[model samples]
Target: MEALLKEAPKVNHHLDHMPNMLVCENLQKVYPTPTGDYVVLDDLQLEIKQSEFVSIIGHSGCGKSTLLTMIAGLNEISGGTIYVDGEPVREAGPDRAVVFQSPSLLPWLTALQNVLIGVKQVFPSASKAEKLEICKYYLDKVGLGNDFHKKATELSQGMQQRVGIARAFALKPKILLLDEPFGMLDSLTRGELQDVLLEIWQKEKITAVAITHDVDESIFLADRVIMMTSGPYAKIGDELVIPFARPRNRKEVLEHPEYYDYRAYLLNFLNH
Candidate 1:
């Protein structure tokens, strides 16, 4: 862990020079309702550099997940553009992969098969052996090596999400979009998964955006925590640059003075 923590500075320094992996400019989204058009997000601008971990937090209806869906191209934009690696994102593709709040796994498929479904979709040209290898590698990386043959119904909620994480990583995407992926778990399980995710992000250096309401989770996982105002036309309210060094220990993070300050500031922002 010490060595990993020491390496973070170098990784961050390298990220400073890399191009933006994801960019949203004047973004907007709206839905046509029975009476009128509902504006969910408007004039929202965000830029995420390569290898950065950023989390967005807000009230339930504040469009946090809506923004993520736009970036993933799962939702349409009423205005502006979203670019991934210099290309405009108009549809869902392998470049951006999303892990939703629910595990959303196929109950009948074994964990290994579930991940392979994505691997095959993204890398259809790979041989069967290669696909299997890719699936197993990520499953093992997420501490699920022994559960590969287990069906989704047989796994715990946490274990199922590990499969979801493995499936997303197996795609080797340019941007990872997570929408409250850990929100359903107990505190202990959520913390465990957070550590697993951090370890993978550190090694892979994939640009990541997560939507989470947990203040501690935001502080621990993100390079920057972006807070949003309440909807119906929500934009970025403020962004806090997390200063804690990585491989951040939960106990150490809680002990740091700025952690509490950050927590209090976020809580106040949300409650205001």
Candidate 2:
């Protein structure tokens, strides 16, 4: 553990020159209770470099989702500031798109239409055909090529999520926030979409932050895994840099020499 901590700085050395896409400084979340204020996150500081993919993990109710929503500007921040591209995050904007566990697609909308909801907002000036092209391209990328015209109500849960992911990417957001986007999916489907996300992320090069309970999914998708301590007042517990190279193969990652050691460290942190 000591050696790993010492070596952590080397992992992001490649990203050193890039500017920070998201910066959370002295961040906090609190709710005013009748009796007293309830605090969730406190003094949580994080710096995500441009185009970086980071996964955050912790036990339930540890402010994992809270933190994500705060960054999304969907939740109020009690203290500190969050910035994207050095601009303070004040409210939800086109620059950041979120994929929740539930796709929450309107039943009347087709898969393509569901995605166009955000696409139109982000690229209103583009021609109708150009918007359709962008939407269809992402849907196909997520393996929803044939279901473009299908209603959100008609698609399976997994398929609905594909639409959600397609929607997020189609908007061309500079930052993507994923709140357990695959939580409702079965293991097999979840694994497939994880790969799909990686593929899209690779091509788009958007900065992303994902909150997941699955540790393997964390290691497989993230360049670095940030673990949080249990909350009433949660903060960054520790972070581990994934040693595997990008465009990773699942099998290769699972078989890497350091896989189990890294896995053990994450598991140990969660356990304690």
Candidate 3:
């Protein structure tokens, strides 16, 4: 643990050179149901620096998905602004890619085709061969090299998720937004994918904000964990800095003394 703290300065120095990635200030969201206006979030603020990994955890119906959608510009903010690299986010763009809990793939398309569509959208100037290469590269990165030709319906849930993950990363977005991407998977598969995501994030230096319910998952992958209160009007409850070392191993991290303590703290916060 002491050695990890000593290495922190080196990590910070590396991060300093990268661009300011995401800033959400006083963000609010409200939905008008037939009965009344539903206030999902209120006055939320968060900043994710380049290459930073942030995890948001909250009780069900706490607006975690709403917050992620706002960041991705898939949904409008009722108030406040989400800025990516100093520009206000107005609509969805290739710069911010999202992976949802469901794979959300086109059932008719092969996994390779699904990824190729994103590559082409982001890099329209690239030749056919270039797009194909990019698709293959990302598919292989997600450990799906042999399954590229499989249709979405043919693949298992975990494999479908691999395709979604591949498609999101293939675009090489400036920031990655994930809304419970692995929440539905079994424990063992979830752990495997978490490691895969960490490796990709490390290698690409991509900024990431993930919404999850699992405390251990957040601790394993995030530099910081932001917990939200339960809603009618959800807002950030606490921000916990994870002092774990970079290039963390899931098994070794679980063995750390502070690991259970942090887990207990988050669990207590959520319950309260």
Q: Looking at model 3, report the run of 10 residues with the lowest lDDT sum.
A: 3-12
Stretches > 4 Å off in candidate 3: 1-19
- Model 2: ten consecutive residues of lowest lDDT: 2-11
Q: If both were scored by lDDT, which would come out higher, candidate 1 or candidate 2? A: 2
User: How far in Å is the alpha carbon of 179 misplaced in model 3?
Assistant: 0.7
Output the number of the TM-score-best candidate. 2
Candidate 1 regions exceeding 4 Å error are 1-14
lDDT of 1: 0.89
Q: Write the per-residue lDDT of candidate 1 for residues 49-130, one digit (tens) a residue.
A: 9888999999999999999998999988899999999999989987888898999999999999999999999998999999
TM-score of each: 0.93, 0.97, 0.92
Compute the lDDT of residue 237 as modeled in candidate 2.
95
lDDT of 2 at 203: 90
**Model 3, 99: alpha-carbon shift in Å?**
0.6
What lDDT tens digits, residue by residue, belong to model 3 across residues 1-272?
Answer: 34433433323344566677999899999999999999999998887788888899999899999999988989988999999989999999989999989999999999999999889899999999999999998889889868899988999988899899989999899889999999989998999899888887778878899999999998899988989999978998877778788788987899987787778778878888
User: 271, model 1: CA deviation in Å?
Assistant: 1.6
